[model samples]
Target chain A: MKIPSNLAKSSLLATGIFWVIGMTDGFHINMMAFMFISYIPVFVCCTGTILLTICPFYFFGETKHFSKRQVFQRFYPYYSIVCFALCAYGIYENTNETFLIGFFVAAFFTTMQSWIWFAKESADETV
Target chain B: MKIIITIIASMLFSTLFYDQHIGLNLTVFSLVTLVALGISNPSKLRMKETLIVMGLYLLTAILVFFNHSLLSIIANCAVFFTLVGSFSEATSSVYVKWLNGIYSSIAGTFHRNFEDKSENKKPWNEDVDVLHLIKIIVIPLVVVILFVLLYKDGNPFFEEKVAAINFDFINFQWILFCLLGYYLFSNIIVPVKVQPATDSDLATENQLKPLEPLNEDNLKKEKQLGTVVLALLNTLIVLYIISDIAFLLSNTNFAASVLSNQVHNGINALIASIIFAIIIILYFFRGNLNFFDENKTLKNLSYLWIFLNAFLVLLIIVKNAQYIDAFGLTYKRIGVYVYLFMTFIGLTTTFLKVYQIKNLWFLFRKNVSVAFMLLVLCSVVDWDAFITNYNIKNADSLDVNYLIELSNNNAFILHQKKDRMVLKSNQGARIDLKYSNYVSVLEQSNWQELSYDNFKLKTDIKSYEDTK
Candidate 1:
């Protein structure tokens, strides 16, 4: 029961969407700094969000079998590049918080691009 | 068994929603959806789907309870339809879901139980289908009721002979309403996905490479046709834009009606031409023609065409701004801006589709997703207040009548602006009307129906009372 790669990729992209949009909303940058100090609740939030995303893929994905590595394949390369670029930009501009968001979205699309490649390759199986 | 469930659901819908405000009744209605789904299609009743449907219901309920404006009502209907569609297909486009939703509603209300021709159908005696029940009971009851009415008009003493079905909840009209509700709930409880529409949305493939051979003669012909059409279109659009800019530069002053006609008609024509542009692009790029080795010229021309259309949209926006500057902001004018912005999004997506050799469904999915997000965002804004306040401050010739026609969302603003406007008496009367409408809007409300906006309005009224 091998799962089509697109569903796993879509779920990853969905999680990135949640992080980029949800983290940036309502809670300001200053509040986000506090989230770092009160780290337990933040950890809980991350776990809940991941589970919320993963549950859907587990249900609607092509197979019952779940592999975390398959979804994360080729993700590190793009994430690393995006992370470095955002870090460099943050240092240059003397802006830390906004570039934190810059990192979220950068990782979002980097993860998105990685998944999109998988999605494209696995299009026939899903469609 | 499902028929019995449908009847129960119908009874619940008719009883709860008959004379109630959209409050907890919406939550109740959502529960009915859950119960119906649980009974008929228990396996599909997952937590994700139930929670999402419940969320949609809660959102619709909250929006209407707060404002109950036309936009809120429209959003409510949209959410309801999306929920109905969600029961059947989880991955279809919102538009297709809406189509499926509306189809289910119509089919149910009309007792057109369009089930699968092979296995889903049951004999009338075997199971009481909606149409069979309609034939056995509703037709006779309706004819008898019609004749009773006619006979009551003909002979004064014949009213009692009609058997006196005049109970408050058991009357003929109420029964018919329940019957219709039963049919509707029946269809909704067991959702139907229009296969072709759902199939199209399920098609995630964006590329056109597999439709035909890249070296096909038709691909070359399509490329040639597309190139010629786009080139000619580009020339014409450039000329049109130049003349438009020339006119805007020269015409410093003009009649209001002239500007109004120009702006409105320009937008109308722009909508048509943009749609035409998209259609042509979709047609030319529909297939393996995109994979043609020499399709670069056609693709470049299409991109230029899209960019020029985007420019045209901007030019119209400028014209609309000029019109607004001269006159005032109204709903129609504001609507033009929203429409233009969405049109720009459409063009951008079209450009992406052609550039990436994506299929038309890709364009649809992107634009529709954006449009839905925009709609959800719009549901949060009180546009009545925005339009009224902006017009009150900036309109050269304020139409107090038009301002008065708006909902109570702008009531507080109008009340504040009464002293500042030249038309004090008219403004005062409009404010009074708003107060009366606000009262009526909340006449049947419990705490569940009171929105934060309503509380704010009440507070505003109280503050005004204290000052007075």
Candidate 2:
């Protein structure tokens, strides 16, 4: 379960951005440029923590024998749908609007990246 | 049959006793849940094991009656985890099995769509099945809507009856409770792979096996380095101990004056020194030191240092006690006591590891088990009430502001002592605001927040009001 260096790098970058945004919201930082931010960091922190915690289980050597591609094939479509629903709810809901939007955006990117990586892996296996 | 009985009993117990004393309610709930599980699967849990778990739960409930302190929360968590772990082990299960159960349950719901297209030909053939489902759905919908319409017609009796059927709003607490119930039920019912004990055995085996001795050149280098480090530490600690006796212990006034400045300032440094001593000992005794008979001096020196560490821990405890005497007790001060106790246990364990040649796992297991037991015992205490009572009676300077800010468990005590409180103008205003907030919280509290502590506080406040 060797994650491609590029994917790992991208995931790390995403984590950093999410963490920084979460800190800003948690601390109630109201810089003029960042006034648009709200509670999105709360959602991102939660989702990001989930992703980080799950990564080790997925990438460990004992799990490598399984078809890694099948993970995304089976789970990603449902994941994407849930993310879409959350995004819609975030936009529609009045409270913590910014935070919800931020959460959905991070979740959306995670779902997309997972789909792309798994799709490519599946294709490579077939080849 | 047993599971059904259990569920029915649980619902009845929760519903009937929902507004009663929280301790009794929680005890009944836990006992019912445990009984249900035991009766449903008598073969899986031994009578002794079941009794032990029940006793722990009973203890937790009893503690709630005493006070709603951090100890009770920790004790509750311990019981929960132990219950889950024991059930999981008894059921021959792993966390993966729980995950799989959740996954399958979700996936099974939508699985018909993924079935073969040929199966659709018989879809209408299963009209009877569809009708049964429709009845199941429509009956509930009709009953609810009918009741709602009837209530809307403005019949007071119907409205009263309808209102009595309390429907909890969909919220995080409700969801969490549901999830907890589901988790407990599922874990008890479903059996999975029992985790092999091989991993722990292998870990202990590795720790027990000594590392290869350093090469002669490296051994000489290490011996020289170890000698210098141990000698320097021993000399410094001995000198500090001597000075402590002369200056701190000999003069009670000096000790009192130092503690008056701050309670736990010097304790941190003492904790750090103990940690460093443990590390230093482990470093020198990495492998068997029998190869060099000369290393005996270092071992003796290390033993002396360990003794000194224990003494240092004692000194810190005495200092903390003096501080408590001058100022007052808080959670942090109590925590420092617990922390120092653990550190002393650790230092003793380290001595055993070095002298008795115990493995790292032995040290770890013994220390953790002791700590767990300590926590369980601690949970039986209501520290908030203890602190409030102690501070009020013992301290020269009373901080009513701090006392008022404590949990509702201490509310009754604070109210009783209200006449004795000496408050400044600003503090008086703050107390008034806090008192109003406390009253509103009591008024706003629902059955969910009902507990023995809160209930008692409420009663006391009511009695006070009645007298007024």
Candidate 3:
């Protein structure tokens, strides 16, 4: 991804990657995504997307540019800002606390991703 | 060739899914994705890959054909990751490959697209290249479309003119769906790997290496320390088990709440302790202790501890059985049984890891594959119907409300048993409401969306009505 437009695509790619990973493994995160996507619990319907859309790719998949690290770095700022805004919006509106949960989700996933990326690097050095 | 397959797959996606619910179409689409993956990576194709692919396909096919549940969908997706990981890298453990599959799917899409885009940038007229054609057509069309839509929103004349422009043939939403499908298909057909993580999984051995202590005598002292700790822990567990068995033998009739506490809170507590027991054992055996010349005493203690944990799982199972016998089964109780079974497997695998000198990865590999297979095995059963029938036959008294809360799989069965059941308060009314809804949905559903259970329930209801 050499161009500015590609940078935007990579950022969107990061969000898509994060969202799908949440779907495959993160049940609670999947719940949150559902809250955002729902009109009277599209959760069950959201589930079939796993089989029809992503599962085949998982069993058999591909992608890269600007290094994964750079792509994530570009994405991290925008992602965190959006999550923080949502978190604040919930408090301001005095709405459901699940809105506040976005910040924690952002933090928790950041730590996990960092560990996945860097901890193995440290571990391989030891090996 | 890749582009053409992608286009076909995308259009197929939109056609199958755009206006319909997930049913037979999903199963068909899943199969198509599998075929596409095989074609794209024919070199990776092997006997084992074929078996895994077919097994997963069978699970998807059978589940959808029978009683497609959320669990089946989940099982299918999870196994998909395991399938991708193992197919691409044969050496890594199942758990590692499972995670790698996700990483590969997401990262691989971007990486492969960028890599392939540089190669496929030729003029669109030469071939029906999606990316090139999309680039040439989509950018300008989208820009103009967006501006026109905005102006139409603001101006009545522009709106009327726009409406008259005969853009009815240009279904932007369908195009977008096709594009979305293309992006997704691109990922599966050209998957990638996270090399470092896979390497780590590959390198981690099951056998414990001998720790060369800075002082040779330290290994002996460490062994002594581990032995004392294990011995003390074993004594405590033995006492706990003896008392637990004695209480079981007392034959005190437990109140529903008391029994619930024993199974839920008490057993869950034991499970937590067992987790700690394994963690402590792993910590001791983490290194040189496995290779110690005089480590037999410590190893024996560890084995005993593991045995005791397995015994605890058995005790919990017995308590759960008693609860089920008294109050009957709920999905919560079934969850407890599954959790305990998993704990038992964990203990068994920990035993193998220690006794056989296997690595953590070996434990992970064995357990993950077992879990995956178990889930796939479970996908064939209609759990709602199973629970309903078991409760109706075996339960002392029914929680009619709870029974009614289950999926329509049990609606026909429960309706049939209404005369025999003694409902408390408005329970009969509740079942009536549920039955009416179930029948209505069954009658109204498209044939493609209805599973065998749904059809069977509808048939059973109709036949019963006819007899009446």
Candidate 4:
């Protein structure tokens, strides 16, 4: 599957981050840490991964053009973002101030990213 | 959107707090989602959706079986309920669409072409009030009434019980062996019966006459064969009724024993039905039968009859399996429903190979033949004598050790069913059984001195008074 070069690169970077996070602190992350880490880096990784998976099929024609590296780059961003947020929530769960702000941010960004991804894919497919 | 948000919130809350009720929560959420989906896009679904949903549910079940996680299991259940709701919504939508399409087509045709028709020149296709009434109200009322009746009759209030003694391990094995024997006999022992080739050359050489209708005499003879079939059927029905009444009338102990036998009989009858189906298939090709005709009404009637009869037979087989268990037979988790479906499908396939008959008649003959054979076998067996002579009853119920010793000295003793309670050892010998106020103490003593004497088993009735 030939994805756009940027999307492919994003997928690869996100894949590496997920592999690391899932095997380590990212895997152990709980609900509270998500509020802080979720919006910034984790959100970026998740959105990136989502874009990488869908972009090639949605934008490119029958010809295969995207490289493995590009494909990986496309997915890595979204994956790293979600994983980091999840890990952050796990680390800072019980603190009252941390949980309230962190949880709100995580919820807002994750849901927004999902909505934006859904709309973009739906619109791209229409063409 | 609001409902969706609420549902999601509830799911998360339930997952965190009341995990045990996850299935219930999922069911409710799936139902609401399904309703929302239908309201948003009902036009996309059709009749085939039910098949898809059933397939998906089965797939999810297989996945959950292998995964063995609570979350996975609950997710599978959620999918299952969602599929159920989606299929139901699709069915209702299809029904409404068909109804509206028919109504509008009729109304439009009438209003357009007959706008100028006078009273004397009334259109031939004018709708009647009663027909509309039937469609709008009466038919639905009838359906509701039938559903209510079915719900009452089909509801299972009592659980089936298994008997404590006399599990038939030997007979079951022998039955399987017999089936294997039949399979071998068909392939190895019996030569295939081949028919003469119906080629033109062979027909000319034999100077075969052109096809003709049967003569009057032959027609009369064939009619006699039909009458014979009818007479035999009537006799079988009578015997079945008698056997059923006798079964109901028998004592509790006898009922338990007999009913256990009856359940085995039902299973055997299912096997026999399969054999009968094979016979029907072989006969169909061999007889050169033609069941179909160009008559549409006849074809529809035949199909309708077959469906209704099949449904009824299925109901009976399931009922009998449950009833047999209740009548003191063991509940083999694998039961007659499985066999019934297998045989029904086999028979239907074979029947389709031959002539299509009225559905009710087809099922009646097949199921009746099975029920009849078992009933006849049960009636001919001298159950009491078998219990006495063959030592079929529990060993403790008979004096086995005493009988063994006495028979060695040229005297054999047989014990039959008795109202009194009894205990005997192996070899048909009666051990000393003494009843007293302190029977437990007596039982604890050495019965070696008392072993030689035959003792009748008895029950001592007592009321415990003021022990408290």
DockQ scores for all predicted structures = 0.01, 0.05, 0.04, 0.02
Q: Model 1 misses residue B60 by how many Å?
A: 2.8
TM-score of chain A of each: 0.27, 0.45, 0.30, 0.26
Q: Least accurate stretch of 10 residues (summed lDDT) in model 2 chain A?
A: A27-36
Give me the runs in candidate 1 sitting further than 4 Å from their true place: A1-127, B1-12, B20-57, B108-180, B196-205, B210-222, B250-255, B424-427, B437-457
Residue B253 alpha-carbon offset, candidate 2, angstroms: 4.2
Query: By the lDDT metric, which is better: model 2 or model 3?
Result: 3
lDDT of 2 at B199: 29
Candidate 4 per-residue C-alpha lDDT over B46-119 given as tens digits, one digit per residue, 9 for 90 to 100: 55764554444454444333322343444454444334333324332222222222222112122122222311
Q: Count the backbone clashes (under 3 Å) in each candidate.
A: 1, 2, 15, 49
Off by more than 4 A, model 4 = A1-127, B1-18, B21-23, B42-334, B337-468
- Off by more than 4 A, model 3: A1-127, B115-163, B213-215
**CAPRI accuracy category, model 4:** incorrect
What TM-score, to 2 decimals, does candidate 4 have? 0.27
TM-score of 1: 0.62
My TM-score estimates for the predictions, one after another, are 0.62, 0.62, 0.74, 0.27
**RMSD, every candidate, angstroms:** 23.5, 12.0, 10.7, 28.4
lDDT of 3 at B448: 52
